[model samples]
Target chain A: MGETRLMKGNEAIAEAAIRAGCDAYFGYPITPQSEIIEYLASQEPHKRTGMVLLQAESELGAINMVYGAAGTGKKAMTSSSSPGISLMQEGLSYMAGSELPCLVVNIVRGGPGLGTIQPSQADYFQATKGGGHGDYKLIVLAPASVQEMSDFVPLAFDLAFKYRNPVMILSDGVIGQMMEKVELFDQMPRATEFDQTWVTTGKTADRERNIHSSLDLDPARFEKHNHHLQEKYKKIIENEVRFEKIQCDDADYVLVAYGSSSRICQKTQKLAREKGIKAGLLRPITLFPFPYEEIEKLANHVKGFLAVELSAGQMVEDVELAVGKKTRIEFYGRIGGMIPTPTEILTVLEEKYLGG
Target chain B: MNEEIIIAGFGGQGILSMGSILSYSGIIENREVSWMPSYGPEMRGGTANVTVILSSERISSPIINTYDTAILLNQQSLDKFENSVRPGGLLLYDTNGITRHPERTDISIYQVEAAAEAGKMASTKTFNMIVLGAYLKIKPLVKFENVITGLKKTLPERHHHLIPLNEEGLKRGMEIVKEVQLG
Candidate 1:
């Protein structure tokens, strides 16, 4: 343990960014997540680490700022709610196509339009399925607790640069606003030493001019770029999938959930087990490189799967793809900022699976 | 022991700060703790509440609908969360302007005149502290010394001067809280 403190998930992430030696953070203020920028401003990171913190005019301005900084191989990140993230889709697509590294955080609120300012998992498809045009994928990390909010900043940045793609920290309002005990890490020195070989640092006399662009005028060249991106995603999929399994050793029913819903499902597991239902929890820390293999393995023993979320049903579709028809699968959800009760989830499980 | 508590009232009632202080106290005691507030725009008008859970073990859900204890501060909050208290659990409240008190026969009900008590000494800003004192007196979930540390931790450096007043309000609250009788 480094230094223990009780902090809101949003504030914890900002403090983590400073500790991680992040170079710049460009974001606007939004409810449930404004604390991220607020905490950053309060600490005056520009004075502490020489980190640049800016309030761009709009979400569009903020993300493009991230795009420009990341082009030079500098660590850059932006955070916003659902609508703000939606606006950044175009920038995310370009970052993916250009093979640039950056971090984007979506402290998701309920949405299709300007929906309620409640927590939601409806952004699953947008994050994992390439919300923007063209075929590309972002490495999405879903944090369920306030502690994970702090821990994931450095991890997200690492994965982003390692893969040369944007990394999205997908969380909901619950995790964003809640307070919990967190052990903040010691400060790491800001990244200074760089090869400056592939990315554009400066065109010196020693090296040839480096070109970076998502636009390939020739169809054949664009197709080649797509192939390269697909290969990268394939490698990431093979190596980067992360998840957690609880009580699965003796499970009869498995609950598949991510982020805050997973925490709720954990309670559902306890209540179900006490009632002799033999329940378990599978929490996917990485929502993009989902825990498909793990769920398929559990299908061999469990009676069925319950996909719990704060949306009507989005991640459930992914669950269907993983288990196929190996076992019965059901969905339980609440939307528009409404969080489901653990007892209600258990009741839904009984009615869907155990009821005759 | 796992103590899942819900504190509910309006904004400016120190509703959020009370939770911050209590949950930070859990940190001083080196226990697993979480504080989740009804932090949406809905809090601007109606009741605002925060769920605080302190446990020896890991906490599962921070968005639970029910709690081991419900500390309500007004008529609207009592109406909203009267049934949220667990059977055989504690339902402590302030009977300041309460038109409808808790009627649950299965739970223990206690009332504190926090508004008047706080007004007697200073502003109603200390109202929430008085209620916190009363609850701690009944439950003693967090040690009093640790609570003082919690107050110190949650309050900013500029507010260090007010710790003694809040401490006094806590002691007064402990003295004035009365157990309610159910007919």
Candidate 2:
């Protein structure tokens, strides 16, 4: 337990990173997410925790800085919106290939190209299935509230280090801009000592020099590395399937949603239950190691499942893949920054399941 | 009880601040609250609005189309959100520069001459406090003491001196608010 204060999600993420003993924050400003960097800059984390806070010229530059810092075994992070995150995909791929642990936050906004600054969950496929060119995955945590926005920062870093992989806090503009009560934790000192066997921190007399690069020219070596990466991802999927089920014990109909859409679905579940329709919500907290097993188990008993999102059927594909042909899985979404209301979701449920 | 309110006005009219203060008041009263403002280009001199939700339990959604209360500070907000208030809900408007009056008969409409009072007090900055005062007089969702405490928490130490003036403006607003008789 800590001091509770009403704070914005973006600001909370910044403060949480500082409290989590992050070594550095390098980010470029973007709509719906600029607050993260702005808050960090204002707090002067350099003064408070001897952390390095630099404003990079571009998202590419910021992510590269993170890759450089993480290569030295330092806890580093960068945040941006969708288009900006797209710019960092190449860098992210390099980091994943090099097995670097770092945190990247995407406070998502609607986009195909430089889209609106309103909230959206359109980056589901881009985040989970690997936006970069590789057989790799980032541990993606989708936070639905300001509290989770704060809580997930440390969790993302812990997991990123635990698996030696990049982690992403997949939030949206709604959560980034919204203000809610959050209990902030006490400050933890930055990790001064960690296993630096693989870190490039200048070779010692007794140790062999370590080189950090993803450029494996030998085909067999690259294939072995890919297999190793696949093994790690398999371990992550087996060990890190996190989700929250609300009223799902005897649900006749279930709604699969995440991030801000999950909050709306929670309300829709209550509205449906009030009308005698048994609706439940399964919110995937970990989007990468998605709760496929839970969804599959639920599919056996539930009559149907509706995948609701702030995008045109993105996560619905994952839901379909998870449940297979056990039950009917439908998708209802609003794209281009348009959020579907609870009433709209309820109406869809009625039209699809209940006799209107 | 849950109160989902939309406070809309011009960018410089402290629309967002009012919502923030209301949310802080909810915290003071030990209630769950959320304050979400419309950001980006619209916040630059254009109409700005914030959705403030206060509930005894955890608030699920911060964004909602309909509202239990619509506090319109200008004609644009009145025209935009007048119909969004739920039936038997409250629509409080400051009779400042509103040209088109709200015509919703299903909801309770109240007018507060907050702008005129603020002008008389010679400080346009206190205008939002007056409007907030009117909302409190009508709904009384949070205690007046909690509102004052919320004001202290929201204001910086350098601006703490203005609290008395805001308190005066709030009292003036409470006195000037009048319920409209819908035919």
Candidate 3:
């Protein structure tokens, strides 16, 4: 519906940030994701859209800058790879505790520490189960394509502000580095609408001064704040569970995957179907409020569920929980930046579940 | 037809750009396309490669194990991707820097002396265009006119004046390409 261009996922997200009316971007360069900041820097968004772009001294500085900008009701964001994201955990936790709205992009690479720059979904647990130290969740949206890489920017920004919570676009190096045809949305004018109640734009005579701090000395008050946050999380889980079911109606077994793994699983489904195996794919677009219910519903009819990921079965635990003891749940993953072929995944499924 | 190709060569040989051209041409034709490069550390001191997929329908995975075609530019590429091409699929290569030639009998092998062709045009930068022209000559996945348009779109404005030279190299490549072996 818009101008179609062959663009890399990183470049598309950068341009989408500008089009999304983002106020500022604070980030450090990291492999597989440096193109994001580089593309933003090349566009000169400051001149084009009055958007601020800064290469911070470190990921800590970058994420804290996002926290500060978000506190002032600015549409702010930051992006980094696995290691840099690890460094930003403290700031992320602080922002979540302070109830700020912003976007954080993690173009995941293989890692426990200093891992290879190749793509991996090892960050699934870190992203969904809380990378930071608390019972807080960053509404994580997993993009499976270059188009979604562009589309999720505005979507994450909207979700961030709507719930006054941080939203992360959890992607991997493969999706970030790959180029595909994407129809980018049209440009929008930037406006600082001070309509939100919690944002501390400025103190004025007509309004009471708003306090912005995550620290609560009283335990009861902090517990009350956490209760409110949990209620918000419940609302998000109820409303924002987005996923795609491919050929599930007649499926004998289902492949549940997200992000890059899901894309590969789509092909695996085709291969399995060609081999007379009724395999389907379930792709979760929202990894935070994951398609747990959908997987549960599919398990009611499908005899087996395969949890395919780039990690050693991190999301498989969630799959097990969804399927329960009634259905068999198997997991197949390739770690340390090595990706499994479609056939390899299919073979794993056939051996694990079908007793091949 | 869905063309899943991998172009492999050392850096600065336009392997990534070759894939980009294929992708841009697919976009112009309103076909689904994806271009994925080898950004891993192997690209630091070794060969660089890119996987390109063009399809009439949606392309599910951008990165895959096998390829419909492998346009190799050097010995390392040929060694790496020779067996990766599907049986009866195309394997185009340049005879410039290749030491050991392809030994694959399961795939159709073709040769294009891209460096020699680009030498005639007095610019090694036109090398990739030559290989691209040779590939298109065999497959014609995208029309030649659309490729011209794609070249215009892919090249920056500063390099626009070199289009005619690239065009010449392309035509020379199309003329000189030889079918070495059939599957």
Candidate 4:
């Protein structure tokens, strides 16, 4: 524990990035998430830790800047909301193809297009199923609280570098704008020594020249590279599945949710338990990994599962797949930036699972 | 004890700040606290609202439709949130802008002339502080000293001079607030 401070989620992310020894931050200002870049700019990280903080003209420019810096083995990151993230998908795909390690924070807002700036979890498929064009995947971490927002920055960087892949922090307007007390971590100096064998930092006399490009042109080479990427993804799936189970051991029903929706589901579970419903919450901390095995195990004991989200229905598809024909999986959500209240979720649980 | 509160008013009325101060006070008392503000276009000048939850144990959700307490500053807020107060909960409102008083029979209602009182004060910025003061008087959820410490944490150092004035406003609010007796 470094220091306990009452801060907004976006501010926590910015401060966490600095403490995580991030080498550079490049991002455009967007509502519900602009505070991240604003706080970073105000801190003058460039002055404090010699970190580079640049405000890109657009989300595209910011993501491409991340790509450029990450290609050189620097801990670089960029943040954006829904529409802006959509704009960065091309860059994200390119980064994934080049196998560059970088962090992308999506403080998601409601959207098929330029939707409302309020919170929404509609980007589940966009994030977990590869928003960008490719067979590549980003290690997506869903942070539910300001503390998680702070903690995930460093965790994301570590995982990104370990796998040599792009990682995304899938948050939303609620988590971005809400304020809560968070225990921050002590400052860690920028990583000075890491494997730079694949970095494009100019060739030395003794080392072979390195190239960072997504295009192989040769079909055979590209196919082999895709296979290698698939192998890495398989390893991540086996080891990186992270989920939290609250009162799940003897639960009759389970509530599956992520990010902000998980917070509401926790309350719903408590309410249900008070009413002798034997409810539990299964919160997937990592959306990309999906925590399929955990849900499958829970399905054996629970009567049903409710996949709650801030969107109409996205993650529920994955839950259904995990539960298979063994148990019923239902979805309850509110769209267009509307957040479902705890009572609403509880009412849904009562109606759908409690046979009320 | 867990208190789920909603503070609502005109965007510039400092409703969000009041919620922030209350949440900070909870933190000062080592309670789990969350303060969530209404974001986006409605916050520009329309009715702005914030949901604040303070609990002895970990807080589950900050988004709530019903509240244990409601601090309403404007008529719009009063109209919107008067019914949102749970039965036996408290509804605190400023009489300055409300045309219709809260009609809830099951909940406790209190009135404070914070806006008119702020008009008499040196600065109108202490308006929310006065209402907060009344809230503390009714519930006394956290210690008054904790609120002072919370103010120190929430307000920047340069704004420290206004703390004394805000405290004065809070004291005044506590003195003047009156509960509406039901028939």
Candidate 5:
């Protein structure tokens, strides 16, 4: 722990990976999240600590490199924004099917196509519901600030390795581009505390082992393998669901927002108080687990709820499932890289609560 | 409980200082805050914007789409962000550059001749200070003592000699605010 120094979100994630004993980094450059690659490029990891850093020809190659490095029980990571992340889905699915542990990051940009340079949470379903083919789930952590971006990378690695599954640090353009204070620590002196019994790190003198591809000729065996994976996912859901609540006590009309949209919710809370409207915000830091229980609790007290997002209607589906139509739950958003102004949000609230 | 703000302008004006003082006041009050600028190709005489977020709680997102309050140092920024002002929000503008009011009736406009006031003080380029003074008078998010303390803390070790003059500029700018108001 040291004095906080200003760093961009992408840079902080890179530093956190180094601290978490991530010896291998394979990535391709993309907007918003480019600083991670830039920071890794500037560091002398090879000379100082034997960390391997490589920029691959494409996102697919980078992901495959992560697969190779993780196979050796080495902490490895690769990062890209939305479109680039889409290209790596095939590799991610393969990694998941093979039960490989590694970290991947998608600093989300406006998307569906190439989109724009601005931020968007449109990739929520893709990340949480599994964008790739076949039944698989990746543990996804959505960071709301640059500090989280830096601090959570090591944690992401810890979870990825602990569960023997892939984990993702889902961020956006705002978190990547903005600079804030972060603390960095030296790399762990002795690594590999987690289980390495399954790793095929060159056959030892006593025994030999082989790593399998995502293939099985026997139907019963493959079904058993997938069933085991589903059990692991069930454990993740039971144990890990993270969210932040503010002034929700005895409040009506709770506002559900995340990432950049959460900032406006904070301001809206302040303004709502001044205008004598009772409102609060529920911000989800971990988007995958979805924080269903917390939203369910708020449904009891609030008369209505608002799902504010950068996209037209994405996370609203999850909210609907959680609330289950007990009250009036509406949504307000701005798509195509346009951000919703606080005033527009306030207008929505006033119309629903105070009557126009 | 202080509010963080970012006022941006053209290259010649004191755009950075507006954000600097707001952040400085937050520091003096022992509040968490930051002032980030648009640099690189964007800062090269083109349109520039800054994002500032201040709160008692941990600030999740620092990106600013609409300012809680804005002090526009030039006409270009005004044209860019006038509609962004919340209904019943404040827009502090330089009357020197903008001869007209913003076309929105929902926001309160406070226009001032910032360049003229700074010029009269022989601090020709310190229009940012003049804008800050005006901001203090109308908004009052930070105290004068805290603002001064933040200014001192911000003074570089090499530029300690310039602190007194900067204080004078800040005080005069705050004083100049009383001369202009919109009803």
Candidate 6:
């Protein structure tokens, strides 16, 4: 309801989390995404409304702290770039196994290891196909704007608790480093109400409570727990797949991309018009739950599709699977801090549609 | 039809606040907007910039490579961006800082002696507002009255005294644009 104001994407997410009644922020600093930690450090959340903001020794420690806070049903989050997110995977899997609800933001950077300071969407497979090990899924929301960066916090929390799962706001260096005006809502009061019947908040009065690790001796109980998680994931897939389409109402080519890469595709759509090519864009807002159904529908209309990204052909695999080889799907990218220019994207469009 | 722009320069030249006011004007018009900034290691006398996207649609991607408009406050920014601007795009430059004329024939370039004009106003930093005023004049995307109202709404509650001076700076900017356009 308020007017927008200039804010860095990292700072905006930090403010949004606090406003959304986050009980704790546990994080370590990492390049391109370190501002989130820096902002929290400056705000000194302990002095303001009892939010515990801790600069952990490592990303590993930070995510485990999130697990502890979330175990008590207190809303909590942690954030880092690719390397840090990689470090936190063990804890993320642990949280998933224990059925703890929390939020994790990965402001992705180019990497197989310490790749560069610039933005890249190479984490697509890591995020969607399971960043962490074992049979589990992280609900990932890819925000392309600073405004959406602020807006996704509450929605992510709602989804996190709705399914008793972790939600990942998968962004990149571009989204984090970029500056934009954001309309910030007044901080809402924390929700203390939930199915406390399952949590361990000191086991107050009526009965003692227990929280345990996912290591089970009995195969039947383990299999049952896995089945329950599988059922939850299935429901998430059925109920939560989300994406956006532009200028695709009647188009022969649909360009599939997400996060920062999708923004480039939007510009490509405009240029494609000038070239007399009917092109559209399919941008996935949620990485997991993948929005397979929508992509399938787009496949029916567009003659060919290309997945453009900062990395070489990561998300293209998903496009091929969704659209099924019926259409020609190719990819174009630049790695290691090299941002793909709009002209480069136009060239790709020309090649695919104009047969150049 | 709100316009989104990025005003980029070295940190000392007031690039941050330049983008800030444009975003402020958009808000006063009751339009949706976002002003995202890059002020990190580059803040200590290195290049800094902010991307302001003001839109009527439910905006998705805030990052833009093809700017509808741009305000280049320094040479580095001009060299970096002058070639990248879209055809028919608007380029507003600081004549006092950038010596080279952009060779592009596709866009309208408005060269203003912003720093010099602001020096006359007794504040070099106010040059940003001058460029902002020029932005308002060329596009008139938001009304002057609304922009003034937005300025009042946006200024910190404690800095009320600076409001009058900022208004003067804005007025100076608009007047200069009119003079340049007429000549």
- For A1-356, candidate 5 gives per-residue lDDT tens digits of 65454566788888777767788999999886888988888776676567888999999899999999888888889999999999999988988998888999998888889988677888888898998998999999988776788778887888888888889888777677766556666567426678987887778777668674788879999999999999999888888888888888867778899877887777787678778888888988788778988898788779988899888788999999999977779898888766766767888888876685
Task: Please list the residue runs of candidate 4 whose C-alpha ends up more than 4 Å from where it truly belongs after superposition.
Answer: A192-194, B41-43
DockQ for every prediction shown: 0.89, 0.82, 0.80, 0.88, 0.21, 0.32
* Candidate 3 chain B weakest ten by summed lDDT: B38-47
Off by over 4 Å in 5: A47-49, A183-190, B10-29, B35-46, B54-74, B82-183
User: How much is the lDDT of residue B156 in candidate 2?
Assistant: 77
Pairs clashing in candidate 3? none
Residue A356 in model 4: shift from native, Å?
2.2
Off by over 4 Å in 2: A192-194
For each candidate, give its TM-score against the true structure. 0.98, 0.98, 0.97, 0.98, 0.80, 0.86
RMSD over all Cα atoms, model 5? 5.1
lDDT of model 6 at position A244: 89
> Residues A284-324, candidate 1, lDDT per residue (tens digit)?
99988988899899998899999998888999998998999
- Candidates ranked, most accurate by DockQ first: 1, 4, 2, 3, 6, 5
- Candidate 6 local lDDT, A260-343, one digit each (tens): 888778877877877788988988998888877788887877788878888877888878788886667878888886777666
Clashing pairs in 4: none
Model 3 C-alpha lDDT per residue in residues A293-340, reported as the tens digit of each score: 988888889889888999988989988888788788888899999888
For residue A1, model 2's alpha carbon misses the true position, in angstroms, by: 2.4
Pairwise TM-score winner, candidates 1 and 6: 1
Per-model clash counts, in order, read: 0, 0, 0, 0, 2, 8
Instruction: Please list the C-alpha lDDT of all candidates, in the order they appear.
Output: 0.91, 0.92, 0.90, 0.91, 0.77, 0.81
User: Each candidate's fnat, in order?
Assistant: 0.91, 0.72, 0.79, 0.93, 0.16, 0.37
